[model samples]
Target: MPLSEQEQRLLDEMERHLLHNDADVVSAPSGDRTLSYRNLVYGALLLLAGVGALVAGVILGDVWGIVVGVIGFAAMLAGVMFAVTPVRRATPVTPREATSAKRQDSASFMDRMNDRWDRRQDGR
Candidate 1:
């Protein structure tokens, strides 16, 4: 079932207002939240481990320690990249746009049918 033009416009307007309100709420930053002390301590431990690997590699002339250090560094870089990327949202289609798209689709379908009919006639 298709919506009438006026109903579609009302829906679109309501959607825009809701998105605007949501944008305002999300943009305000509250700074009361504190980082977990345990997590911070664990992060420091990981940093120390990386430094230890590098120092041990240089002191003992072991190439495998260097490889371990490189792998840890790569993992950290990948985590940062994943955190910064934004999630994409789907755009809502209005009734007018939907109708236009349907018309175009039907036009192409009719064209294909006409071509098939012409081919059948030629063959017969």
Candidate 2:
């Protein structure tokens, strides 16, 4: 069935209102939050290599070697941090959604049932 002219106008008005007032809701994976297992494995291997290089430098007791060893240790720290750190996933919160959530903070099942009953009574 087709909507009545008045209903169509109301729906169009509502669509316009929503388009103007509602924020764009997009769910996308940020590069930081998307950690692949392959990268993690590679990072772990890099960390191990870095630690070994540092240890070898220390054992050799050379100034240049020590510098290289420190560099390796820093690399190792970077790799380890990369491997251990988890991706932070966050959802973009819109003002309307925040307000609506706050408004319905404690709305329970019974509250919804009562609201439905009231609507039915009003409709009748």
Candidate 3:
């Protein structure tokens, strides 16, 4: 079933309010830290290596095996930690850069939305 006219109007009002109030959120700058592809690759390799060590440990079946198994578990845990940790960006985003980037990316999108809304209102 379709929304009633009143429901549609209310929805439109809510959208307008959200767009107005949440423009900052929509255009928010990514902070100083981000995940590195290099780190992800390295972490994955470490994790695989850890798994191999763990399997070998199981096969050995002795005190040495226990030691290797513990080491492997530690490596796997470290790999996961390393993979998820975000690194600091080399160059910090200046205020000017942030503003310009945000405007360039989001202005056209916001303009398009506003234009569509205007057209919808005019049609009504």
What's the distance in Å from true for residue 43, model 1?
A: 0.7
Q: What's each prediction's TM-score?
A: 0.30, 0.40, 0.53
Question: Which parts of model 3 have CA positions greater than 4 angstroms off?
Answer: 1-30, 93-124
Q: What's the TM for model 1?
A: 0.30
Model 3, residue pairs in steric clash: none
Give candidate 1's root-mean-square deviation (CA, Å): 16.4
Computed on alpha carbons, the lDDT of every model, listed in order, comes to: 0.55, 0.67, 0.76
Each candidate structure's count of clashing pairs: 0, 0, 0
Judging by lDDT against the true structure, name the best candidate. Answer: 3
Better of 1 and 3 by TM-score: 3
Which parts of model 1 have CA positions greater than 4 angstroms off?
1-33, 71-124
lDDT per residue (tens digit) for residues 1-124 in model 1: 9999977865665454444446456333233333344545555666566566656656655678677667556545544444443433344334365455445455555575589799999995
TM-score, candidate 3, is 0.53
TM-score of 2: 0.40
lDDT of 3: 0.76
Tens-digit lDDT track of model 2 for 1-91: 9999977865655554454445353223333454557669978998998988898888878897888799889889989887866665454
Candidate 1: residue 3 lDDT (0-100):
96
Ten consecutive residues with minimal summed lDDT in candidate 2? 23-32
